[model samples]
Target: MRLTGTLDPVYNLRYVDSVNVSYYNNRLLPGGGRITVSVPVHNNRFSAWVPPLPAGDRLVLRLRYPEMPDSAGRILDVGGVSLMTGDSIVELSIGKGTYNPRLKKFALKADVVTGEQNIARLAYLGAMRLRNNITDTLRKKLYEKTIDSMAYNTAMQKASELRDSIDRDFIIRHPSSLQSLNILETIIGRYLNKQGGWNASGNKRLTEIDNLLQALDRSLRDSEKAQHLITSLDRAREMKLIPFTGIMPDGSVFDVASLEGKVFLIDFWGSWCGWCRKSHPHLKELYEKYKDEGFEIIGIGEEFGTGKEQWDRFRKAIAADGITWPQILNDPARQDVVSDYMVQSFPSKFLIDRNGKVVLRVLGDSEGLLDAKLKELFGK
Candidate 1:
């Protein structure tokens, strides 16, 4: 087959990337796959071209629907424009609906929506290039402040702060873009601050002391940070400010406070969520050992597809694959949990003691560390 190519700066780029997917059941090793995204620069519309598969595989895809990234359009807080910021529609020409593998194209047809904000992303990249020499201390401060402010809801603010946080070399490698953790924080932080205030008090004071502390926290909080967001979310749940309930595996429901007297593991996941399943081995081992010690692993299935079919398959997958732990199919994802707890990524876990207080919030590998952690926590 011969492929013809043309350069139409706005509408001619057909790009795709490969992603690694893992089974929640811990039995299958992660596999790599491809996703194609079509961005019509002229119409500002985006479409995804999912790979076609056989019927059985297709069913699995349905049960565990992939979390298609929003082509920078579905960026939760694009440009620091939060749900809280009104009249801030930054007109992103986003096409709705998922890729219909049957049709091998987007399901809802190609069209444009009113609220996509890739502009912030563009501005963020531009600013990064313009001011590539910000000091680390200031950059960190900007990161924290951006997170604190929730500027991710808007494009301009996100672009500004992100520009400050970006590293010069990263862009040099990928000149068309310079994005990652720093960008997420700066944009997301701003959005969160404006929309919901990180599930905690805004700390909006203008005092020097507060500003200094904010700077310090921002500098100190880096790629290694954990629990801050989770802690904030937990605090909000305790206050009963949000009228929300969460769905657990087994198709049950409960609020965070309801599971108070148990040792619980809030596993953040989704059916099409590959990263969450990546930690199955550790989860399995942890459950096997500590389950007898009153350990209850309540997986808060995030994303969509928390139904029985998916849950059962997930459970079976883990069991057949070596995980014999109890799981609650989580619904509404962990809205309060993620927001209050400030969970930003997947496979993140929060260890709760019997009395219902968090012992630790883990962001990285806990598979090998689970046993050691439990022993220390159990004082055995």
Candidate 2:
């Protein structure tokens, strides 16, 4: 199928500099075609021109500035006229022109955006959309429940799950009526005031929490459109036996591809794991000695049963401990990485080589042990 963009900022991007774009073997194109473009910003409005694109293909903008990638800056990712931060609003035009009504709209490439809040928004929107589509997609695919049951119960379940998730991970300051991640105690507190559930008049607390979370996440931002594409992208990757996003306790975003070019030792852990946090100093020392030589270690925390609020606590714990490498939050929802690496314990590490291949799978984390390995591998 042929693919392209539209005349919208969400779809349009002109290279501010030519050095940023590259071609991938993922598709066949000449001159290292621009993978993704940052729609230009001017006035209070931001818009990008997307050439007429085919429906099922994926596009990712390698947003960069001053010859370096904007690691923390927000870039608008949109579809149609929706200006957004972390996700993309699917163009009605795209849907009308390309997608069939019976098909599911899932994102295939989520990591294209490196911005943290941006990624969070993208994932949040994706989850919302996924929740909405349970009747249309999951139930049909899995044949689990009726559409009516999936809609009301599934959405409520998703919101409740989301509440438990961010309650610890994000320092939510939102009004109880504002949204879920903004404030859990407040949202649930308000829901309690609503008499609980759509039909209940006495359990207001549950009602308010459900409504508030629903409002904050409705429709999603344009940036999430890319994220939606990524969700679809993961299915494609699964065909290749690659893992999608893996949730960890650090609550940080993890990308299997981003670890390229460095030797990475990934540790799956938890804050409650006394053994996990204990490995930090040694990891710091390892990073200090081999960082220059291209050896690195990433801490992936498993907060699966611990839920979401633990994520914020997890980050604070790291800050309190002075953690210095990439970290990711892990949960049962996204634990493919752990399964992929076959992690059997806490403080587990998978030592990857410079070429991004898994080299040492069983190497235990020993204090000052990485320095010796670096010396052997790169001769420090």
Candidate 3:
């Protein structure tokens, strides 16, 4: 790929003597490799040849001018195009107007070479904006008050409904587009992860996703992303064993197999996760109330950061939080449990019945729903 841009000569002469332009491909390769390229600006113009990328991959451009100061007057004037990628030539014109040093902003105009590329670019840009808006809105609402669980649940449910509506509109408008397929995949994956397993609504959503996938080009349908979504949907429907055996914080071996003949919950959590910490009291309450009735909880703490210091911190946090359940702290070097369970997020829970089958999967904090499930199972 090639990029061309013109930076105002005035800005170049007064503020920055030179600028560095770089592009980073945001697609993850099969072996966890990344592709990136960089080039220097000459006479206010810059160009570079990017490495070949997969068809649906994204590439982002970044600009760094070390001589220009940022808002604090200590940092560089660093700006770039937002997340954008796919096969296309990107043209950007910067510093066309007066640069405001106080605002630390520059005027930028960007365009793609082809119509098809423009559509793809707009689709991704829209999707990213929607995601950010939803997340930011929910976060603001959640932290605005002393977290009232009822209010939080209501806000989240409304946000989810809005997201679903937006996703459906995308599918309806751009059924054959790769961006639509991506949106469908995201919707289905979130449903599988968040909704209680295998309900009628869940089944209906899966059917809709499958139909949309079928409507896409056969090559697109056979893409890695599509296949992965299909597999995840299939797995969500099946009651498969998610086996885990690890050492507890107190250094005792804890195994899922050992919990046979009892109803249990496998809680995926971590010390650093705010949602996990928020749900601790509810989990402890359930465990205490039902421990005599053959109900148990196995907390698996995932530590992604380095060093035994993290583990030590986790132990202290767990104790301070009054989490008395049987706990397993993950070895950062070996994340087999996380991979086995496809745990993309923290505070995930799986309810296993006495027959050793997973009966429910809850993502995030849904303590009320979990309590209801436990009552139904134990007839409390």
Which candidate tops lDDT?
Answer: 3
Off by over 4 Å in 2: 1-252, 304-306, 363-365
Tens-digit lDDT track of model 3 for 90-182:
665555344558866444434443435445657656675677787677678668865676877887788777777777776666655667665
Model 2 — TM-score against the truth? Answer: 0.34
Q: Write the per-residue lDDT of candidate 1 for residues 76-144, one digit (tens) a residue.
A: 111221111111232322223444565444432111133222233345445554564443434665577
- Among all windows of 10 consecutive residues in model 3, the one with the lowest summed lDDT is 24-33
RMSD of each: 15.9, 21.0, 6.1
Worst 10 residues of 1 by lDDT: 55-64
Native-referenced Cα lDDT, model 2: 0.44
Output the number of the TM-score-best candidate.
3
Candidate 1, superposed: residue stretches over 4 Å from native:
1-121, 129-250, 254-259, 273-275, 305-324, 333-336
User: How do all the candidates rank in terms of lDDT, highest first?
Assistant: 3, 2, 1
The candidate, 1 or 2, that scores higher on lDDT is: 2
Model 1 clash count equals: 44
TM-score head-to-head 2 vs 3, winner: 3
